[model samples]
Target: MQEILNLEPQNIWKNFYDLNQVPRPSKKEEKVIKFMMDFGKKLNLETIKDSVGNVIIKKPASAGMEDRKTIVLQSHLDMVCQKNNDVQFDFDTQGIEMYVDTDGFVKAKGTTLGADNGIGVATIMTVLESQDMVHPPIEALFTIDEETGMTGAIGLDETILQGEILLNLDTEEDDELTMGCAGGLDVTATKSYSVENLSGDFKSLKVDIKGLKGGHSGGDIHLGLGNSNKILGRFLHESLNFNAQISSMNSGSLRNAIPREGHFVISTPTANFDELKSALENLKKDILIEFQNVEPNIQISVSDVELATNVASQDETKNLAFALMTAYNGVYRMSPEIAGLTETSNNVANVVVGDGEMKILCLTRSALDSNKKNLSETLKATFELCGFEVSFSGGYPGWRPNTNSEILRLMEKLYKEMFGEEPKISATHGGLECGIIGGHYPNLDMVSFGPNIFGAHSPDERVEIKSVQKFWKFFVDVLKNTPKK
Candidate 1:
């Protein structure tokens, strides 16, 4: 962590280290809120904490820049808490353990680095402490619960912020400016079944689908990565030929992340055990071949386990597996306007089977409201047709691009002047708070850009060290050149 402080932008890394010391998982930001409040008070900045735990700290303009328009440096306080299954770390009780790799990427030990928005938050803090830097009156607006839900943005008081320009620091790419993002909603389906007694002699086994590269549901959806929930469904659907009855099952914990692993406990008649094993092996071979390049480590295995007295009824198990298999889990539509951009997608995020009940959760996203609704309806219809009760929640809107805006023009010009090459202009399939905030402030001019980050929302998350320095230079320059209103 000390090494991170020694980086080119000392203040940014220092503040990031401070953030890492506190737990700030989505919907669990009390400690980080206190930390932010104390930070603002120590700096003598005017700080306000909203009813929803959103923090806003204001600083006046530097000399000769008092006439410049107020600018908002916006980022979220919460991070997606994901870690390796074998690592025994509790997000609520432990701070992130970060280290720098030999390749100059900053990463956490067997856990997500929280750089998705931690770096963004740190950048805001550094700018607030900048006494020698030229800038407009700045408002560092840090929202809460962005990863799991947009609660902070939804509950934010619009009147609190006087800034016309908002610079979102949550994007992942260094050379790209994000002007728009997809809106999203979570769909959950549930089914009830009777727990039946094991009446016949049966063999029990635990089947696990593991070792897949699960990542951000929206950002990595276009990569065609393997989803563990879908793969588990496929295996179960295939095993039905051997007359297997599921006892219980569980998979992926978060709705916004693509499920990387799934576990299923099942039983079959002793007569069909050999056939089930052979069929499972064949299915594993086929799945490995299907995702060989992108998910080389994909593992599917079944191990013997003690039999439970009760199990899900055969009909219920079949319905759940079939439903999961038929559900959408990848890129749905490509943007006709932009090459290689995903217009809409779905992630079959999680599944859990327990006493007399089975649940499946999915998240869908699209830039267009009509498309978003269509996707949601499509998911609902699919699940409904499969004999499950479905519902949607935590829906958020998408941000629209303003290509002719003053902020975009200034940033584009300054970025090119600084780097001698034009930065790529595009939108993301992932959800950003810009859309929700923009909904409240209708005339807000917004653009989101950040340093290079990879594998967000997963334990493999890392940030490029060199890109942070470059991003800092561009950020300060952009603030220095904020046009007078």
Candidate 2:
């Protein structure tokens, strides 16, 4: 920890190191919230906690800066909890095991590092406590459950915050300033059928797809990373011609991440088992080459299993496979306005099979409300066409960008002055609290920026050390130089 403190990016990295010592997975952020509130109390700042566990701490302007503008610094307290199957760590009771990588990136051991917004939380806390620092009147807002949902931001009252300018510290790229983000919704599809007994001599086998780099659906959607569930579904669909019958299938854990692994159980006639194995080998070779650069180590394996007493009818199984393959996943459309931006995408995140019913959960996102609605309808139509019941929920609106925003102009100038180059201004494909916060405070000016983070929402997530230092310096400069109208 002391070595981490000695790193060049002093303030936020030190705070991040301390934050990693606590457990704050989504929907389980009480301890982290209490820790923050207590720190505010100790500093004699005016801190308030909402009924939904959101915290806001107000710090008066430093001496001679009392006449400056008021700004809100915001981030979520909870992190997306993820870990490798072999790593046993409880999200509710255990802290993360963090270490510095040989490449100078800080990451958690086989788990998510929580740098997405934890860095934001720590930066605000450090800025508030730094007596030697000079800045404007500040409000640090920490919301809860940003991973599972934006419940804390949705429940926030506008009257609680008087700041007219908001700076979101959850963006992933250090060189880009995110002015807007996509809105998203969750879709659940279910299908049920009676089971039929298998005939003739049969060999049971387990098929798996693993070792792909799964990432945030919105941020990494265009990267062409393999979704394990989609890949496995395609393989099983093609292999069904070998007279394979699926007993059960399961894949992926989180709705917001592309699945890295999947498993399924299937049975085939004992006589044709050798032929089926040969086909699997061919398929593996083809897919491995197809995804060589993006998903190297992507593997498909088969093993023996106890044959199920009954399995879905051949027609039902075929329908399930077809639906899985046809259901839209990955980039749906590119932004017409912003060249090279993904305006819409979907992730086939979770699949479960039990008791004659198969449930498929998907998440869809789009920066335009109309586009989001159209995409949802398109998916719902697909599910209904396949004789499945479909439902949608948890939809949220997008944050529309304000090109003439005073804060945007101020930050743009401050960034150019500090770095001697214009920051890349962009809109993210993923959802953010800015959408909800904008709705609550209709007149507030907002923009998001952060250090370079890779593989977010997955076990491979990490933050760059040098990027944090640059982001921190720019953040401090913005606070000191930006003026009110």
Candidate 3:
């Protein structure tokens, strides 16, 4: 903790330490709401907590900068709650245990370091309390539920914000100034089937797939990382040839994260159990050889387990396995307009089957509205043909890139002057609140930039220390350079 406090940018890290102490998981942010409210009041700023739990703190311009345009600095309050499965910490009650990694990154112990947006929030807090920092009139917006549904940004009352420019500090790469981001749709598939009684001669076997490098489904989807759900589903689908009957299965958790672990229990007649086990073992070897470079630590283990009383219906099991194996994942398409940008993609993030019921969740993303619907239709057809009811909800439009943006021009010029090189102007595949917030305030010129944050939406999340120092200086300068009204 002291090491973090000693960083070059003391204010950002110190405020980050204090902010991390309060639990701020998505969908459950009551405590954080209060924490932010208290923070604003303690600074004696004009703080207002909206009816929908968004916090806005207004600060007057410093020195002679009152003629500059009003700027709204924004960051989400809630973070993606993910952890190593073996870790015993409860996100709901315990503060994240953070440490400085041997490698130049600050990370949390077996949990996500909330640096994805926490650093932005802390930056805003520091600016709000600063006595001498040059800036225009500032409205600091700390939104909630960004990691999950982005409901706070969606539902924010439009009447509050009076800013002409919004600087969103939520992008991952420090050098990349994001003018756009892909929208997202949540796809849920569900069905229930009858379970048949296990025969007396049946034997139980447990299978596990672990150690794959799961990551942010949006940012890392193009990396070709393994999805545990896809891995287990492929195995079970292949095992069906040997007449294996699934008793229970579970894989992944959050819809927006790539799955790292998968587990299932199945049974087969004792007469041919050996043959099925041998085939599975051989397939594991093939899998290891197939993904040797990417998934060196990936393990596919099988062991004996206590016999289960019921097995999922054979027909239903076949359908479920088929759907999982056929479900499209990974980079669906790259942008034609922007070279090297992913235009559309899907993550088969979660699957569960047991107790005569099965559920699957997928998050699909695309910058083009038509492509988004088309991809969702393709997935819907795939699952529906397999006898599952698919539904879409929690949809949010992507932020369209505005090449002629005034704020973008100002930042581009400022960045070149400050760093001696032009910043990368790109649109992210990940979801950001700028689109939603912009919808409410059409005239607001928005852009997002942040320090380097890697492995977001997963337990491996970390942020670079040096980049925070660099980003802080640039952030302050942007405020100092706000255009005259």
Candidate 4:
């Protein structure tokens, strides 16, 4: 813990350590809210906690920078809580336990490091309390529940902030400035199915799917990684030849993360058990070859399991399996304007089957609102055709790009002057708070940039140490050069 506090730019790292000591999962940010409030009050800054749980701390400009326009430093408070299945820790009860690795990365022990927005929050805190830094008047806006939904930004009071420009510190890449981001919609499909008695003649097998690199549904959706929900569907679809019936299924968990593993219990007649084994082997080989380049560690296996007294009825079983196989998954469209940019995508995030009921959850993202609706409708139609009731919620607009804006030009010039390499001008596929906040403050100039953080929204999340130092240097300079009012 002392070593982490001793890292370069001690102010930022120490604040980060202090922030992570509170249990701050998405939609459960009471402790962190109190922490931020106390930090602001203790520093003698004017802090306001809005009704929606967002925290705002204001600091006046320094001597030479008082003529510059005010700007908002924004980051989310909640993090996506994910851990290895073997790790036994409670997110609602414990703070993240992180360590600096020998390979120049800071990571958590078998859990997500919460660097998605924790570093940004810490950097804002440092600037707010700094007496030596030259910067414009700052309004530090710490939003809530960004990972689960943009409810904080969505429900914010429009009159609270007086800033003319907004700086979002949530993007992952260090050398990239994010000018726009896609909107998101949560698509859920659910239904109840009938159950039937399992006969004594049925032999059961547990099909396990594991080892896929599941990541952020929007940021990593273009990577073409394997989805466990879809993979389980494939295995079940293949089992039709053996007359297998589903007894229970549990795959994936979060609506924002790509599912990495699945556990399903299925039963077939004893007469067909021998033939099922051979067929399973063939299917596994084909799946491996299909994803060999990206998912070399993909594992699929079947083992004996005790039979349950009941299973999904034959008709319901076939309907669910076929729907899972036919449903939309992965990137739907690529941006014709930008090379290698995903325009629209979907993640079959989770699927749970048990207790004679099933629910399917998916996340859809796109920079265009019409395209967003189109993809979502297409998914709704697919599930509806399979006898499931579908609905869409938590819709947020995308941030439109302003390429010729003052902030973009200023940051681009500063980045090249400092790094000797032109920073990449790009937009993120991930859902950023910029879009929602921009909707309320229509005239505010906005751009998002941050240090290098990778594998966000997953347990493999890590942050680059060297990149943080470089980002800090550039950040302070940007504040120092804010446009004059």
Judged by whole-model lDDT over C-alpha atoms, candidate 3 comes out at 0.91
lDDT of 1 by residue, 345-396 (tens): 9999989998988999888999998988898898899888878999999999
lDDT of 2 by residue, 347-383 (tens): 9999877579888999999998888888888888988
Q: For every model shown, what is its TM-score relative to the native structure?
A: 0.99, 0.96, 0.99, 0.98
Off by over 4 Å in 2: 195-200
C-alpha lDDT of residue 91 in model 1: 94
lDDT of 1 at 343: 93
**Per-candidate local distance difference test:** 0.91, 0.86, 0.91, 0.91
Clash number for candidate 3: 0
Model 4 TM-score (2 dp): 0.98
**Candidate 2 at 280: error in angstroms?**
2.4
- Alpha-carbon RMSD of each model: 0.9, 1.7, 0.9, 1.1
Per-residue lDDT for 80 in model 3? 83
Q: What lDDT would candidate 4 get against the real structure?
A: 0.91
Please provide, for model 3 over 99-133, each residue's C-alpha lDDT reduced to its tens digit, 9 standing for 90 to 100. 98889999999998889789999999999989989
